[model samples]
Every structure is written in structure tokens, then in C-alpha cells.
Target chain A: MKLWKKNIWKNTILIVFGIIILLPFFWMFTTSVSDPLKIFSEKLRFFPEEWRWESYREAVSKVPFFLFMWNSFKIAFLVSLGQIITSFFAGYAFARLKFPMRNLIFYIVLGTLMIPGQVTLIPLYSIMAKFNLINTHWSLIIPGLASPFGIFLMRQYFLVFPTELEDAAKIDGCNVPKFLIHVALPSSKSILATLGVLAFIGSWGNFIGPLVFLTDLDKATVPLGLYRFMGSYSTSWPELMAATAISIIPLIVMYIIAQRYIIEAYSFAGVRK
Target chain B: MGKKKWKKSEVMWGYFLIAPAISIIAIFALVPVGYAIYYSFTDYSLFHPPYFIGLENFKELFADEDFWQVVKNTLFYLIGVPVGLFVALFLASLLNDRTLKLAPLYRSIYFVPVILPMISIGAVWIWIFNVKYGLMNHFLGLLGIKPIPWLTSYEWSKIPVIITGIWQGFGGSTIILLAGMQNIPGEVYEAAKLDGAGGMKMFFRITLPLLSQSIVVVTIMSVIASFQIFDLVMVLTGGGPGRSSASIVQFIYEKAFRSFEMGYASAAAALLFVVIFIVSIVQLKISQRITNY
Candidate 1:
């Protein structure tokens, strides 16, 4: 009986702490649906008294939701596709190809990992301005296409892949592209999936790049759209939270769908470093 | 060395495969860095054709008090990175206990903050930290103390931003650390317990030492993230109270975009780059030594 009580107490403590951690998110969702007056009310309630979907409607209607979503989708899709292609080839080159200065080039790319984006921001900005690329989607899309981290991640994943398969493919008279396409890619589906999800999520959530480049309202991405909402309607907590919820919903869904794969691949490879 | 004849087709295909990536990097990353280096040595404004002034920008930067103040603020910001990460690691360790139920639920709850936008959080934080009619003030009111000027006061402004940052980021650190902790061998802990090691003893002796690799990874990621911090500072205080909260990135932003001092901004950015490069190298060296030890 005493042991049972101890277990029960421990379980209760865990549950309470769990609730505490979730309190803000719960409040965000609740406030998004709640009346504006009740949000700031002295009486703190966990649940909304009345569930109103109007706030969500108001949030969507306030901005070009579809256009912004499309902009985000276009940029994110191109970025992910581009990263996958680039990282795969680069990763293969670093892992398999024999060339002079390969290690030197690989290390140079790895060195880019340490340099913070702040260092590159002004230089990139000036270059973009010179091309008259500011306020253009290409400005956002082009820079994101070549990610040093993607190369690093792909390299790490590629290192552990067995070389016997490649050798077999070569013996079968398959060229490097054929070997990569037919054998290597088929085997590395899981890693590719991991990289694809990560790239999409990173591009989708990146705020600073879009903020710097997308000066035109029509070209604004989702995060920037949310920023503009917050600035224009500073008093509308309900609307702002609603907008935040909408913007993050897709990412959260993606996270849930890929959660198992993400954990498996990332923990397997991630902890090794 | 066995000299393998390179197929022209194969080499051409390799180049073709990599062309898109290289061109983008050249246009966006490499060229910008090159121009930034050039501009760092100039007196270029937005209108001017970047006339050569030979180290003038860097020279002026040395005498800029605001620049020094931003450096101090950035150091203050970086201090939270380690403290916050350690706390997160501790939390991850706790949550990783086998006896703990609903681990995924706990994990998701902690990770929620990380998914939310910094701009949105900054908005919420501003309301929370407001001196009058704010939640923080009201909570502090219960203690019978005067309301603190969180964003208005020079001393207190940066700290609240730092605290909010810690809260939002600790969840991610917890998730990554938890992932690391999951890799620890169960028998190692079992062996320690069999040797009459208590909870605290096991944690310090076994859990922490085994978790060094993750700690290093987490430290590097956190430091990089902290150095690039701009949105929260941009939204919350706008580097108020005479630029007390102006971080190096925000300073660069203001100089380049707001003031249109392209050359000066590029110089500042180069300095930021050098600092991050040096710090990251130091981290890598320290991690290497730790792994060796």
C-alpha cells in the first residue's frame, strides 16, 4: 500500500509538470478562440467559455492567406528539392569519389557551418541589392538552395553507407549516376526522407531571410505575413494568436507525421557526432 | 596510386549534377562574402560607388561606443546559452527516467515553444513584461514591490529578453539532450546502481560524463543560435534605452537597411563573422580534447 502511494505521488507530480509545460500552448489555443475581453480578465481559466471560430476567420481574412501560403509552399518546396539534389551529389562526392583536394573542399564547406548567418547577412544583402533582387522571391529562394548544413548532414549519413553496393554496381557496368540512382538512392530512402523533412521545416520556418529580402507585400512568406499582422493589429491578441496557430499548424502536422522517422534517423546519426 | 582514367561523360555529368548548387552559392554566398570584404575597406554609402578608404570603417568601429555596448550585450546574451542548455540537459535527464510515464506527452509539451514564431513570442512577452497592467507586474505586485520597467529600463530590458529566449529554447535543448540520453547504455546505469551509487552520484558520475558529446553539440548549436538573435530584439525593445539591447546583428541591420551605411555595416558583419569563426573553432578544439580525454 505504501509503495502504491509512492508510485501514485510520482505519477501525479509528472502529470502536473506536464500540465505546466503545456500551459502556454493551451492558453494560446484557448485565447485564439476566446473573446478578447476574457483573455485579459483577472479570472484565469484554462478553457474558453465560448468557442468562436470567427477569430480564425478574421485572422485569415485580414491577410492574403492563400497567396502567403503559396509563397511559403513554393519557396519551401524549391528549397527542399534543391537541397536534396545538391547534398546528395556533394555527399556522394565527399564519400565515394576520388579526387585531388576533395578533403580540402569538404573541410571548407564544413567550416561554413561555424560562421553564423549574421556574418553573411550584410554581404548577401548587398549582393542581392546589386542584382536588384531585393523584394523578389528569387532572392529568398536562390540563397536557400545551397545549404552547408544539408551538405554536412548528407555527408554524415553517407559515411556509414556500405561501399560494397557501389562496387557491385560498378562491376555491373553501371555508371556513377546509374549507381547512385539505382542502388544508392533506393537504400538511402530513409535518410533522404529525414533530410527532406528537415529542409522543408527549416525553409518553412525561416523568418529572417524572408524579412530581409521580401520587401514586396505580395511576395511575403507566412512568418513575415504573421509579423505584419502582429504589427498592424497589436491590440488583437485573439487575432494574432489565431494567425500564429494557423501558420504553425502545417509544421506541427508535418512534425507529427514524421516524428517516428525523425527520432529514429536523427538519434541514430545525430548522437554519433 | 592506381590511376583511373576519368570518363569525359562521367566528369561532365558530375559537373552538371552540381552546377545548380555551385552557381547559387557563387551568386549568393561566395560573391557576397567577397564584396563584403571589399566594402569593409571602403567608405561606401548606398548612393556612393564604394570609394576605397582602406580600413577606415574598421578604424571608426574601434572608436564607436555603441559598438562596444552591443558587444557587452551580446556577451550577456551568450552567458544565458550555457546556463539555459545545462538546465535543459538536466530536465532531459529527469524526463528520461524509466519510471516516468507519458514521456512523449512531456516531450511534445516542452517542444511547443520551439515551434512557435519568435515574433509571436516577442509580442506575447511584451504584454507579459509591461510595467503596468501586465502579468509580470501583477505577479510581482503580490510581493508588495514596485513594478519594474522591464523593457524601458536599460539594465533590466535585455535580461527579460534573455529569459524569454531561454524559456523558448530550453524545450529544444531538452528534446535534443533527451535524444542523446536515450543512447546511454542501460547496463552502465545498472552497474553504477549495483555498486551502491545513489541518484545524485549516478547522475554526476555516469549520466553527465557519458553525455559529454551531446553537451558539446548542444553548446555549439546554442552559441550559434544566440549570436544570430535578431527578431526578438527587433520586436521587443527595438534596442531601446540608447541601444542597450542592440545586438551585433541588429546593429548591422540598422546600419545597412535603416541608415544605408553599406560599407560600415559590411565591416561590422565581417567582425561578427570573425568572432563566430574563432568561437566555433575554440568549441571544436575543446570538444576534440574532451573526446580525446
Candidate 2:
């Protein structure tokens, strides 16, 4: 009976905290559909008295929302795909292969993770300028394609993989690439998904990279588009909120679908480091 | 001869596998950082060729009051680190209760904010803190309190940004700490219980000491993240109400992009790098000391 009482108190507190955390999100959705004029009224209403669906229409039409989303999708898709392929092969080599200077090379890869991006921003921009890659999606996609963190995460995952499977595959006359494709890759679904989701969400939400590299509206990503919209229409709260809501739906959906793997993978990364 | 050829082929394949990633990192990360160090001593605007200035940028930066103010602001933002750590540890303890039902559901709810884009978070909070009709003012009004200007007031500007930082970050930290807590041996807890140690006592004596490693990791990460704060200040406040909340990174961005002072920006970035490098080393030393206990 005493234990039951404690459980009730604990659950009540958790529920209240959850509501407080979620209130801003709730307000965002309500404000998006609320009447524009009524939003600034003296009395704040939790639920909108009058819903205006036009805000969504105006929000998208006012900016090149589709183009921005397309750019974001393309950049994220390509970067995640590239990182997966590169990190997989590199991780396999580091974990399984016997090579000269293998440990030293792996340490070099780990060392890169400590250097923050700001240290390289200026010269990277100049290098991009030299290559005439500025204002192009390649600038964003290429840098993101080779993450030290991804390589490290993949290496860690591969290190623990059972060697028995590889031995069996070798006996069956499997070459290195064939073993990677048929044996290792098939068993790595969870790690791949974890890395894919992380890379996708990261590239999708990246602000500084897009802010620095892409200047044109046509090349803007979702965050950049939202920032531009907020700057131009500071007073248009409803439309701004509508745009903000629309922009986060993909992230929210992705989080919901892969919450377990995302949290586990990230915590593993943190703990292992 | 066949065996020798196979060994050679294997070594070649290993090199082939890692070459692409290594080359990209070398070009993008390593080389640019080298150039950043080189550019710090030279004046280069996009229109003009870079010329050696021989510490002119660094000399000017030392005497610049605005740079000092932004540095102060950056240090001030570190207040969020302790606040975030405390909140994360508390929430993690609560959720770590094995008896707690729907823990996964609650954990996901808390983590939702972390995954959302900072732009969206900034936009939503901007409305929530709107002086005239914000939800925050509405709550204050209910308590017979006057509305406070959240983002516009210089004194209050940093508060909301700090609050949002903690809110967005603590969820991840909480998950991390919880994992660390679980790794603590069950035997320790059993011994504590047998010793008649109360909840708080056990927490301090067992949980905290055992959890010190994760705390160090989280603290260092938080400090690094708070120092690099730009997006929140950019979207929410714009260093507002007379540069009250301007961070060092924001200043660097403005100098680089707005003023086109490439040399000065590189100097500032180099200084930031030095500070971070020192802080990380210090943190490593401290963590090592704690682990020795």
C-alpha cells in the first residue's frame, strides 16, 4: 500500500513535468492556427477560438518552402548515404584488416573529432571559394560526407562483431568486399539506422553550414528558409509559427520512428568516449 | 609467390578502403585549420590579396573593448552548464526508478525538444516571450504580476536563451547519466541499504562518486556547447538591445560575413580554439583526479 502511494506521487510529478515541457509545443500549434489579430489580444486563450487554415497556405507561398525542403532532403540524403558507405569500408578495414600503421591511422581519425568546426570555418570558406563550390549544395554535402564521429561509431560497432561469421564466410571463399556486403552489412542494420538517422537530422537542422555556404533563396535549406521568413515577417506571428510547425514535422516524425535507437546510440557514443 | 601476392592485395585493399575518408578529412578539416592558423597573422578581405600583418590583428583584438564584452558574454553563458547539469541529474534520478511505469514514454517526451531544429525552437520561444501577448506574460498576469519584457530587456535577454539551452540539452544529458547510473554495481546499493543509509545519503556517497565520470563528460560537453552558442542568439535575440547578449562566435560571424574582416575573424577563432583547448585539457586533468578517488 505504501509502495503504491509512492508510485502515484512519482507518476504525478512526471506527468506534470511532461506537460510543462510540452506546453511551448502546444502553444506553437495553437498559435499557428489562431486568428492573427486575436493572437495579441489581452487575454491569452489556450485553444484558438477561430481557426485560420490560410496561415499554412500563406506560410508556404510566402517563401520557397518546397524548394528549401527539397534542398534539405537532397543534402541530407546524399550526406548520410556518403557517410554510411565511407564509414563502413573504413570501419571494416580498421576493425578487421591487418595493415601497416593501422592503430596510428585509427588514432588520427579519433583526433579529428576533437577539433571543432569553427577552427576551420574561414579557410574552409576560402577553399570553397577557390573551388567555386560556394552557393552550391556540394559545399554542404561534401564536408558532411566524411565525419570522424561516424567513422568512430562504425568502428566501435564493428569491433564487437562476432569473428565466427567472418571465419565462416572466409571458408566459403568470400572476398573482402563480398564478406562486407553479404556478412557484415546484413548484420549491421541497427547501427546503420542509428547513424543514418543522426546524420539526416543533423544535416537537416544545420544552421551555420547553410548560413555560410548558401546565400541564395533557391539554395536555402529548411532552417535557413525559416530564419529568412522569421526575419522578414517578424510581426506575422501566426504565419511564422505555421512555418515553424511545418518545418519540425519531419524531425518529430523521424524522432518518433527511431527514438530507441537514437537515444541508445547517442548514449553509447557518450559513454564510450 | 601466390601467397605473397595475396598479402599484397590485402594490404592494398585496406589502403583503398580508408583513402577516401582520410583524404576528405585531410583537405577539409586538417588543411583549413592549418590555413586558419596562417591567416590569423595576415590581413585578407575577399577583394584584396592577403598580406602579412605580423600580429596586428591579435594586437588589436587584445585592446578591443567590444571583443572583451563578447568574451564576458560568452563566459556568462557558461552559467547554463551547471544549471543544465543539475536539472539533468535530478530528472535522470527520477526516471531511473525501476518501478516507474511509462518511463520510456516520458523520456521520449523530454527528448523531443533536443531533436527539433534550433530555428524552430527560437521562433516558437520568440512568440512565447512576446512582450505584449506572450504566453509567459499571460502566466505572470494570472498571478497578479505585471508582464516582463523577456527578450527586449538587456538584463532579461540572456535568461530566456539560457533557459532554452538547458531545456534543449538536459534531456540528452539525463539519458547519459541514467546509463551511467545503471552501470553502478547492484552490490553497492545493497551494501548501502544494509548500512541503513538513507536515499539522499546513498545518492551522495554512492551514486555521485560512482557517476563522476559521466558528470565530467557532460560538464565538458556543456561548457564547449555553451561557448559555441550562436544560433539561439542569432534567431532569438540578434545580440539585441545594444549587444547585451552577443557571444564571441556571433561577433566572429559578424566580423567575417558582415564586415569582411577575414584576418580579424581568424584571429578571434584562433583565440577561441586556444581557450577551448585549454579548457578541455584542464577538464581532462580534473576528471583524471576525480577517477583516482
Candidate 3:
């Protein structure tokens, strides 16, 4: 009876806070479908008083929404792919290879890991400008290509992989890279997925990269574009919400699909850290 | 990892494998730290040759009221870290309940916001904090409380921003703590239950003591993350009414990009690095004493 009572109390607290956290997502959807004038009514309508779907149409057609989405998709895809491939190779090297000064190199990686990325911002920007890549997508893609954290995650994952497999694969005449591709890669799918999903999620939401490096409106990603959208249509709450909803749909869909990978990633991060 | 001796080809492949990542890190991350340190003492405005100005940038930055306000706002903003962690711990404990069958659904619901772009988050929150037509005010009105300016007033502006941050943030930590909770052996709980330890008692005495390592890790992550609070603040408040809520990063942005004060901004960036380093080291040292993991 006491356990049941405690369970009931726990449920109430969880549900209430869950609703509070979920309110904005619900509100974003509701406001997107609501009538423009009805949003300001005396009655606090939890749902839209009138379902207005044109807000979505207006939101998309008003600006280069798809273009921005494309830019974002490209950046996220490239950044994730780049980070995964490079980190996997480097992680494999650090974990399994025999080389001169391997420990020293790894210590440098660990040191850089502790140094916050913000510390590198100004000089990186100048470097970007020096290379005449300031307004281009390369500025965003290049820096994220070799993630220290991703490398660390991969290294840790690889370090635990059994040596007997490597020894067997070597006896089968497989080269180092070949063994990595054929054996190790398949074995550590979950962590790689985790790293890829994390990088995708991060690159998708990246506002600072676009804000500092790219000034061209057409080159703007979703977050930067949506920010600019807010500036223009500040009065049109429904339209703005519609735009916000549109930008988020793909991510929410991706989340639904890759959420398990995210859980794996979180657990990996927890244990490793 | 066995340190078995390898052939020349394999040894060369080892260096080949690392070259790309190391070179890129050098170009983007490592070299920049050196450049930031060097340029932090120089007066360069992008167009001209940089001349050394010693510690003038740091001295001026220390004396500048705007810089201090940035520091003040950053300190105030860090309040979200602990608050968010507490909320995360509570929610994680709830989710940790074995009897809760709908845990996965609730987990997804809580975590959805963490995955969304901050600008999308900021847009929804801006309207939620709207003085007249906002949902926050609408709920307040239900309780016969009048609407307060959530984003405009000097006194009330950061309130909604902080709440929004806490809402979006706690999910990540909840997931971290949930993982931590799972790693706690069931035998410990079974022993506690035999000793008549109640739910609250178990959480405080058993769970928290075991989960201290995770808590330290989460604390370090949250504090580091809190210092870099940029995108959300930029969208919701733009550091607001009078630059009163501006973050250190935002200060760096304004000084470097807006005002073209490269040297000054680099100094601020250098200080930001040093501050983060010191705080991280302090947390780590403290954590070492408290938790053995």
C-alpha cells in the first residue's frame, strides 16, 4: 500500500513536469494551426479555435525555406559523415596501432578536449577569412571534420574490442584498414551511430557557426534563417509558429527514428566520462 | 590493446590514419589557441597590421562596465546549471521507477526539446513570454494574477529566459542520470528494502551516494555547457533590455564583429578559456576527493 502510494506520487510529479516541458512543442503545433486574430482572444484556447493550415503554406512560400533546409541538411550530413570517418580511423589508430609517441599524441588530444571550442573562435574565424572561405559552408564543415570528443568516444569503444579478432584477421591476410572496415566497423555500429546522430543533431542546431562565419542570407541555415524570419514577421505569430513548426518536423521525425541510438550515445557518454 | 610488434607497412598506416585528424585539429583547434593567446595582447582590427598593446585589452576589459555586466549576466545564467541538474535528478528518479511501464514514452516527450534547434525553441518561447497574448500570462490570469512583463522589463526579463533554459536543458541531464541510476546494482536496493528503507530514504541514502560519480560528471558537463549559453539567449532576449543579460560569448561577438575590437575580444576569449579551465580543474579536483570513479 505504501509503495503504491509512493508510485502514485511519483507519477503525478513526472506527468506534470513532462507536460510543462512538452508545452512548447504542443503550443508550437497549436499556434501554427491557429487563426491569426484568435490567438489574442480573451479565452485561453488550449487548442486552435480554427484550424488554419494556410499558415504553413504562407510560411514556406514567403522565404527560401527549402533552400535553408537544404543548406542545413547538407551541413549536418557532411559534418556527421566527416566526423565519423575521420574519428573512426584516428580512434582505431590510437586504440590499436603501434607508433612512435602514441601516448604523447593522445595526451595532446586529451588536453585539447578539455579546452573549450569557444576559446578557438576568433582565431579560427580569422583563419577562415585568410583562406577566403568566410561566407562559404566549408567554414562550418571543416572545423567539425575532426571532433576531439568523437575521436575520444571512438578510441574508448575500440580499446575494448578483443585483440583475438585482430590476430585472427591478421592471420587471414587482412590489412589494418581492411580489418577495420570488415571487422571492427561492424562490431561498433552502435557507438558510431551514436556519434553520427549526435553530430547531426548538433550541426543541425548550430546557430553560432552561421552567425559568425556566413553573412550571406542565401547561405543561411535553418536556425539563422528562422531567426531572420522572426525579425521580418514579428507581428505574424501564426506564420512564425508555422515556420518554426516546419523547420522542426524533419528533426522530430529523425528523433523518432534514431532515438535509440541517442540513448546509446547518452549511456556511452555517461559511462565514458 | 596489445602492443604487439607490427610490420613497416602497418606502422606507416598508423601515422597515415592519424594525419588527417591531427592536421585538421592543428589547423582549427590547436593552432587557434596559440593565435588567440598571442593576438590577445595585440591591437588589430582585421585590416591593419597588429601591434602589441601589452595587457591594455585585458585592463580595459576589466574596467569596462559592459564587460562587467556580461560577467554578471554569465554568473546569473549559471544558476540554471544546478537548478536544471536538480530538476533532472528528480525526473530521473521518477523515470527510474520500475513500476512505470510508460517510461519510454515519457522519456521521448522530455527529450524531444533537447533535440530541436534552439532557434525553433526560442521562437516558441518568445511567444510564450508575450506580455498580453502569451500562454504564461494566460495561465497566470487563471489564478487571478496579472500579467508581468517577461522579456521587456529590467527586473523581470531574465525570469522567463531562465525558465525556458531549464525546460529545454533538464532533459539531457535526466537521460545522463537515468543511465547512472540503471548502473546501480539491484542488490543494494534489495538490502535497503530489507532494512525498511522507504522510497525517499533509499533515494537519498542509497541512490545519491552511489550516483555521486555521475553527478560530478553531469555537474562538470552542465557548468561547461552553461558558460557557452549563446544561441538560446541570442534568440529569446538578445541579451535584452540594456545588454543586462548578455553572455561573455555575446560580449565577444559584439566587440569582435560589431565594434571591430579584435584585440579586446581576443583577450575576452583568452580569459573565457582560462576561466573555463580553472573551473573545470577545480570541479575535477573536488570530484576526485568525493567520488572515486
DockQ of each: 0.42, 0.72, 0.74
Can you tell me which runs of candidate 2 are displaced by over 4 Å?
B1-7
lDDT of 2 by residue, B1-293 (tens): 34323377678889999998888888999888889888899998888978899999999999999999899888999999998999889888888888788888888888888788888899998888888899888998999889899999989988888988887888889888988998999899999999999989999999999999899889988999998999998888998878899999998888888899998999999999988888888998988999997
- Winning candidate number (lDDT): 2
The list of candidate 1 runs beyond 4 A from truth reads A1-17, A233-235, A263-273, B1-16, B130-149
lDDT head-to-head 1 vs 2, winner: 2
* Candidate 3 or 1, higher lDDT: 3
Residues A168-235 of candidate 2 have per-residue lDDT tens digits of: 99999998989999999889978988888889989998998899999999899999999999889444
For candidate 1, list the clashing residue pairs, or say none. Answer: none
Local distance difference test values of all predictions, in order: 0.77, 0.88, 0.87
Which 10-residue span in candidate 1 chain B carries the lowest summed lDDT? Answer: B10-19
Higher-DockQ candidate of 1 and 2:
2
Worst 10 residues of 3 chain B by lDDT: B2-11
Error of 1 at A53 (Å): 3.0
> Model 3 chain A — which ten-residue stretch has the worst lDDT?
A263-272
Question: Per-residue lDDT for A162 in model 3?
Answer: 94
**For each candidate, what TM-score against the reference?**
0.90, 0.97, 0.96
Question: After superposing candidate 3, which stretches have Cα over 4 Å from the reference?
Answer: A1-5, A233-235, B1-7
TM-score of chain B of each: 0.94, 0.95, 0.95
